[model samples]
Target: MKGIRAKLSTLLLTLLLLVPTMANAHTVSTTGPSPDLRSALGRLLGEHAILAVVAMQKGIDGAPDFRKAANALNQNTDDLTVAIASVYGKDGAAAFKTIWSSHIGYFVDYVKATAAKDEAGTKKAIADLEAYRMEQAKFFADANPYFDESIIASELKHHIDHLLSAFNNYANKNYTAAYKDAQTAYTHMFATGDALAAGIAKQFPSQYSDASSTNPASDLRSALEQKLGEHALLAVFAMQKGIDGKADFADIAASLNRNTDDITAAVASMYGKEAGEAFKTIWSSHIGYFVDYVKAMAAKDEAAAAKAVHQLEQYRMEQAKFFAGAIPSLSEQTLAEGLKMHIGHLLDAFNAYVAKDYAKAYADVRTAYSHMFPTGAALAAGIAAQFPEQFHTANTSSVPSVQKVWFQVKSNLLTIDGSKTTMDTMPFVNQGTTYIPLRYLAEGIGAKVVWDASDDSVWIIAGENKAEFWLGADFMEMNGQRIEIGDPIIMKDNRTQVPVRFIAALFGWDVRYNTTDWSITLTKAMAMEASSNHH
Candidate 1:
């Protein structure tokens, strides 16, 4: 048992370390509208939030990779320098860089203190972070001379608080709460990014006046990018559910988000917005259909599955019409290339899920989704055609982060110690007294079932015998086992959250999740096997 855990941990460490190497040696990313002061600062703050997460992850993982973490911190400081330079020119940017770098050092101290469990050191570290916030806020305002420091501090304070909470949650093993806070931190960062971009465009108009926020930088790209993000989330969950026959999906989602944003945006601009929307609607519909198709396929419903494919074909033609109508300059040939890319993404996700190759599925999902680049060029190109100088004159390619990072998977109700230990690691739901679907119960007896999408029926089989799963105003089957009372499967976030008891019993193990208190317990079957093997 220890050996397996060790193996998994080592693999995890290797994975986390690789992320920074691909991330340009932990340095800050500060491209796009560099002449705009506000945008520059926003990007800096955004990077800071990301760094904090990276730092926390490293701390928890207890990695020896200091250069990577430091590089990430340095990158953030570099962004700060960029913003200051834009606002206060060379002198100010240089001054702020030194002060900003100090916080990174202090953060390193904090991580050390945490590892040593030093109470006083922890307090001191926290104090340093607070001081960094106030001083940096003031410095930025002073650098700009015209902008108000108080407002900057106030706007950023909430975001900083969110980041701190996430770090704390991770420290305490409250991953569920940590992840919940993480969403807020990341989402709010985008707002800061947008504000900074707008501030830069507002401050250094000559260099960045042509940016636009309303339209993405281009018309050819919007729909594809949107679908890509959705695809990212889906691929992760599907793989996690074991519906895809591959490895973990979380890592894949992060990589995709980091790598593809630019490409998605560039491609969309070539097509236009209305056309993008048209593509998005059809593309999104297909994903839903694909999910339905999986259910039908699992059930061996040949007719239903065929019907799904037919509907998808119809959607493609209709989608083609929408693009043809919106794109005035690009003929069918150019559109065809872009269309193929979109189709490739969908096919990749669907086919991977169908094959149960979840790792490959996620790889495709990440590739497809994170490919959108929300840049000033794409935004400007689209706006240039419509509003001309009114929009083209303003630099506003401010792609704000999506706030609200609630747990999509692996939330907890309580911890082993009776505290809100963490809402991470795995998904959980509240136990309830409800009727059990026969197929769900049958799963415990060495059977698999498929849910029918069109009729919402569950088909089950176990060694030639057959049963079905019915929920909500449905009749009971005579053959399947009874699900114990007080452990009903609750539906949350589209996935059904079954009581741990059912899964453990069906799978020959023990499990528990206290959604009411936020805790989880699982005793795998292998543990007993290992014990027996040991004895």
Candidate 2:
């Protein structure tokens, strides 16, 4: 889920480059009890995505459990409808149900059409789905002032496209691609859920109290919770598929691996790449032990099964110790105790399935899935405590004073709001254009700076505005349009140097050059009048 978020963020950063003011209007809250509505919607919506995929696959295969899977998906929709009712009343719930169910029917129609090789029927189903997107978007837009009809429609389109991509690949027997897309579709729903919940909380603040959904700590918790819960569900599914020797077993395993990558990458982001790799080694080993247990049970090897259990016990300690060493708030004993319950749930669920107790197996699966939410919260709290600065929320509305920064050409001295500091690299001028250290200047103004190693791109996010610049690119992309810089970005003393004027322009910083002092002053006022005017 974290990986999917990263990919989605990259895509959004590109799209949002053109609409700076609207980008950060409604931030999604992912963690804490204050965002319970967000968590609930995320869980149900995510479940719906996975269950829809399962139902479609079962329908295509004529599996005996197709009806049951379809029922589960419908139940998720019903739950979602109830959630909407709490905010919009009975009539709104009915309207929501009608539109939502229509989209589901369209998906079912698409599956049936594809299975029957009815190309025209498939086309019509897709066309209907496209139309359904608008109706659904309009419903949400009318219900919430924070939601734009066009933006809602765009998000709905992506959701539809993901599900369709998954099912289409499944119909074509592209199992690997099918499962990958399915996992993506599943994780994408949490974002949608958070968006809806955030808007609802804003619309009725009295009902939600003063809890803000845009808090950084809450976002971290929610993200980890969603990913961990997803891991539990996928693990159960993979174990079932493996034990039954299903043809899609390998694909399910692949999906689980992808999930692992996301989890490890998240660890990397918080603990560095080396720690991430170490975490992956410990984490991947547990999955392998689970597989070994399944294989042993299939062969009725009692000794092997016992050995697998022993390996799992060892893994719990290692995993717990690793986290305890990294997070001061987490104790090895506590983490191990929690992990014991997790291992037990998966093993118990698998054992139930093997014994033909299908009801208990699924019931245990739900228990296992629900367990991860708190686990995620625990980890999020620890991480937030460990790195408070990283999770600090940017309060754009409470700028009580102007932020003024000054930089002198060929000098490493920097001044911010009357405080002086030294930068590693000094600002310089080339052909009469002054270039400032990207990181220092951006961070001085409460903007977020990110370096993407994947493409050697630099992204700066300030309030609702975002700009992307590549290492050697002579142009910067802002608000969806490219502005030529006349010269390529340069690296100085291991720091990224960019034209200060462009940064000032994008973020609404007032710039003044002093010919006598050989210094440039940038000021960002509380009202952001200059920025609004520039835009």
TM-score of 2: 0.69
Off-target runs (Cα >4 Å) in candidate 2 are: 1-34, 209-211, 392-535
TM match of model 1 to true structure? 0.42
Candidate 1 clashes: the total is 70
lDDT on C-alpha atoms for all candidate structures: 0.44, 0.73
lDDT of 1: 0.44
Mind giving the per-residue lDDT tens digits that candidate 1 earns over 442-477? 332234666667754455543333334344311222
For each candidate in turn, the TM-score is: 0.42, 0.69
- Candidate 2 per-residue C-alpha lDDT over 132-231 given as tens digits, one digit per residue, 9 for 90 to 100: 9999999997898655465467558767877988988988889897886777677667767766776687678788764655355566676778778888
Q: What does the lDDT read for residue 72 in candidate 2?
A: 64
